[model samples]
Target: MAPHERACFYVQAQAPQEKLAFYFAVQSGGNFDIDYEVTNPAGGVVLDGQKERQGDFVFAARSAGEHAFCFSNTMSSFAEKMLDFDVTAEHETQADHPSRQNPLPNAAKQREQAAQSLSTIDEMASRIATGLTNFHRSLRHYHTRLHRNMDTVRSTESRVFWFAVMEVAFITGVVGAQIMAIQTLFNTSGKARV
Candidate 1:
């Protein structure tokens, strides 16, 4: 984004009290920081910050509607910013317990409990898998940036070294020429006096 500009992206939450999770970062920017704000559909601020490089947040939805996540590069006058973000909405997925005329048998209750436990475990596993994938992706991006920076450093070093070598060679040639000129002048003067 250009300097002093703000961009907003929104995700809709259909059900009230759903979970909203966001991961945001200024992947490349003037100073690796930018202004950000998260607002609910009613224009209530959920989160706000300035000069932040990254943030991971989870907020419970109070109202069901579009939630806006905004990023601003307003502090910088001449620099552009690049942002990366992911927003996820998780709704209640578990079924409510059914009303029954009689108490469930012990075995059935145990089986139901087991199923719930398994569901919870599955949800946790899925979250873990997603986290790991995002982590690896971030790692790869950093690795590529590191390699590019190293290449730039190497190029600069090589240029500086060659420039220094050329400067020394030029100075040596000039000094030699001066010495030769002085010797020739002295010889001519001595011969003329003789």
Candidate 2:
């Protein structure tokens, strides 16, 4: 691809340590995997993974190029399945790019600074989305485990409640029997004295 063709105006200065990532879709006509290998123009491997399941094939691009990205789905073990994928080049400007490099309408030299500002906001939104996804996954895993143990706890509570009920009944019975015996003794003594 040309310089500007594949090179989307990315927030490089702000996120210096962050790499450019693209989500790819993989589909197989047979029981195989579209295992992918992403390499730079220099043949250096940037990423290598198999899209075994239906999920984001996330990767990072260091520099611009028709970066030799490849995928394979030819396993001999499983029945031929189907796969579909899309390469969504992310980490670049989604809403901000024009104003940073080129000027928008009405402005000649100073491209409306909206591009950079909007890109910053875009970066924030992206981070928030990622964070929320992670939090949600963690919450799901935690809830699953919590509920798994909760059944045992519920059964334990039932046993404890039943034990408490039996103890209460026993105590009440003993107290009533003692009261009846004391009344009988008083009546018998009074009658004998009469």
Candidate 3:
């Protein structure tokens, strides 16, 4: 992101009351902070913040349409920032409904009961998949941070090593010059006495 620049993204909700999960983290640059805003389809602000490092939020849609999520780097004059973010729009499934817990007794439709059980199993599988995806993202983010820190440490170590070498060379040169000057004075004094 550039100074005074804003980036906006849109997420669509197909039905009313859908859940929207928003998450973002500043990976690097400019103090690892940014300004963020989330607006609903009606242009109403759902959430907003300034100079934030990261955020995790979940909200239900008031009406079906597109929602906007924005990030701003206006606070920084020369530093650019990088961000990792995700927006998930999830619809409520029938299998997840509370009323589905107790269905009316009907012996005529044994196949329907079996189908409902399958759907329940499918929902569980989907939930597991989502969890795995989130876990993978976290792992990647941490790996990036670790790699950056390692590079910084290596650079610092190299600079320190070179500085120590230069200091040793400088000291050696100064000592050699002093010894030559003292030797010249002693030779001159001895010659004059002879």
Best-performing candidate as measured by TM-score? 3
Superposition error at 74 for model 1 (Å)? 1.9
Off by over 4 Å in 2: 1-20, 24-32, 54-59, 77-79, 91-194
Off by over 4 Å in 1: 96-194
* Clash number by candidate, in order: 0, 13, 0
Q: Is candidate 2 or candidate 3 better by TM-score?
A: 3
How would the candidate models be sorted by lDDT, starting from the highest? 3, 1, 2
- Could you tell me the C-alpha RMSD of candidate 3 in Å? 4.8
Worst 10 residues of 3 by lDDT: 93-102
When summed lDDT is taken over every stretch of 10 residues in candidate 2, the lowest stretch is 1-10
Alpha-carbon RMSD of each model: 5.4, 16.9, 4.8
> Candidate 3 lDDT, tens digit per residue, 1-194?
88888999999998888999898888777677899999989999999999997777889999999999999998899988878888999877554443345555664366566668878888798899889978977886686577557656777899999999999999999999999988987878656867
| Among all candidates shown, the one with the greatest lDDT | 3
TM-score for predicted model 1 compared with the true structure: 0.61
Q: Please tell me which model should have the higher lDDT, number 1 or number 2.
A: 1
* Structural similarity to truth (TM-score) of each candidate: 0.61, 0.33, 0.68
